[model samples]
Target: MDLDNIKDIWSQENPDTTPEISLENQKELHLPLEKLRKNMRKEFWSTIVLFVFIILFLTFVDFHFFKFKIYVITLVASMMLITAFYYYKFFLLYKNLTSVDFNLLENLKDLKFQFKLNEQYYLGYYIAFVPFTVAEVILIFEFIPGWKNLTGFSFILYLSIFCLLMLGALYVVGKWWFQKFYGKYFSQILNLIDDLK
Candidate 1:
């Protein structure tokens, strides 16, 4: 940006000053923030694509890709897919979540607090799913012919219980996270948006 253009923007603070601000200077000021927003959107979509592909494969293709049986392949594929997606998505969400240029410091500080709280909740999600994931993978071994007698009903029971446990964990985590982070700041952001309107 040209010095005179920078001077123009800086001069806005002081009515007594007369300075020219370059268009380049204005563009430069906004460039980083725009880049950050675009990068965040890109990261989000990457994870979304990963998840959609996993769902597509599981829903359509049979999983016998190698020496692994279909059941084992499905179990491993699903678990790995979910784990990677969650890890990647949460990492990006925490890393990219940000705000700035608000009119009030209190509002900005609240938004900062929300970012921290959300990171914590993502960590919670990572922890809660571990047990469920283990159980989900075990169902594959039970599909072996003779193994059905030993693992059949028990396997189904484990799957059912694990699913319920996962949901309960998610609910608890969500509630706690909402109260800890999102509940307070969400309303504030909404109010700010409304006021701007």
Candidate 2:
């Protein structure tokens, strides 16, 4: 065969495989995406159930102190509201899993944005609990007779220290919870994105 004919044969024989490789990468993404969606849905439903139980308890149980009841109910309601908002945000992310409309890089960037947004939401969610923590301390002092012994600067000192300690503990616990629920999938998605590069 002539040189041009040989070149034509070579070109046709070794057609570009880029599209095939892209399809495979898209397939690879589905597993992690499904896992992330499944996990989010599970957490969302569980949170709803928990808040329902809390609402029922708040409705039925009569704590002798009206202020205690008010504080506890308010705290639970606030938590439920925050959780609902986050879950709505999460659901939006989950819906994106079904469509592979974006290229791999774009998807990775979007996922990274979601992960960071969620981390912020998680921190804020925990921070929201601080007020309730302080209220609990206040209720104990006001209603629980034994705590009356702690008064003046001693009371101020103890409450301040306790609130700080509780807030710190909450931060740690929230971090752990996020890691437990999300760390594996987050790492997997990151690795996949890196592999694409």
Candidate 3:
């Protein structure tokens, strides 16, 4: 065979057309995505349930002081806003994640976007709770007769310490929650993308 003729024939084949994936192979490829979708949905519904419970508690439970009621209302309102915004975000993520017809590169790009978005969301979500946590401490001081004496620098110190501790705990818990739910699948998808590359 002439070398130039063989090279010309090989180069004529369509390079853009990907091989058709077998059903079993496609299912295997999508397994991580399916698991991620399930976990995200579970998180979304659980958040809804928790929000409903909080609303019920705030509406039904009696707080003798008007200030306490106002605090609870504020807390609920903030929580509602945060939850709504994040739910929308989660919905978009779910929609994108479950979408089909994407090739390997597109899938990898989407996954990387999701991983980064989630990291930002996790940070914002935890930071958003800081105000409520501080409010709880304020309410405790306001209501509890014995603790009312905490004031001036002492109160400031106590509040600062408590807030810092709560933030630290929230950070740790958020990391663990994400790691447990999405991190494993993220790693798998990353590996798949790498292997494809």
Candidate 4:
């Protein structure tokens, strides 16, 4: 074939057409997206308040041992750092959702991916605290007067069991919390995508 003829055929075969969401579908998407954004805002602000309360409580509360206060404050500070990282990502998604033009199906798909990715991040945020929890527990045992009575293998065994149980509980609670806050809206978005498809 001549180059001119081949070019024409290629142009005809590959039109620059992207699937656009209909106005009706865009309207359908608005509710769930708004719900997700609202929930995110509420959670974010609540977390900030809770952290502030924790810091104040730690600073002002009377503890028998000074080391206990320091250790907890340090752990809370570390948690705040980790939380800041995750919230930065969360804020990006919040911004994306806010700015969604809903013009293309691909945009919705990308938003869905963001939701799923952030869901994983949410769980990781919880799991990340496991070490902090363990350390805090150890501090409690060391500094608290009552726990001093437990000695040797008994302390080790109890701490191990408690940590194991806490690990499982965190995972379960994380899943539940996600479902309660965002999963329902996520389901709605998935349904909207399916309808669009």
Best-fitting candidate, scored by TM-score: 4
lDDT (Cα, tens digit) per residue for candidate 1, span 1-197? 99999999987788654343345543443444354445445756776787688667666776444434455455656666655666575555445444344444344455456556655755665565665555554554445455446556876786667567766776687678555543454454445434433
Give the best candidate by lDDT: 4
Error of 3 at 46 (Å): 1.0
RMSD of each: 13.3, 5.9, 3.6, 2.1
Candidate 4 lDDT by residue in tens digits, 1-197: 89999999999887677789988889889988888999999999999999989988987899877877788888989999999999999999999999977988778888878888988888789989999878877886788788867899999997888778878887788889899889999999988887887
TM-scores of the candidates in the order shown: 0.39, 0.77, 0.82, 0.90
Better of 3 and 4 by lDDT: 4
> 66-95, model 2: which lDDT tens digit per residue?
877887778777777777787777777777
Candidates 1 and 4, the one with greater TM-score: 4
Candidate 3 residues 8-28, lDDT tens each? 888888677654434554566
Model 2 regions more than 4 Å off: 1-21, 102-104
**Residue 175 lDDT in candidate 2:** 82
Off by over 4 Å in 4: 1-14
Model 3 lDDT at residue 72: 75
The lDDT of each candidate is 0.55, 0.75, 0.79, 0.87
> Which pairs in model 3 have colliding backbones?
none
Q: Answer with 2 or 4, whichever has the higher lDDT.
A: 4
User: What is candidate 3's CA lDDT for residue 85?
Assistant: 88
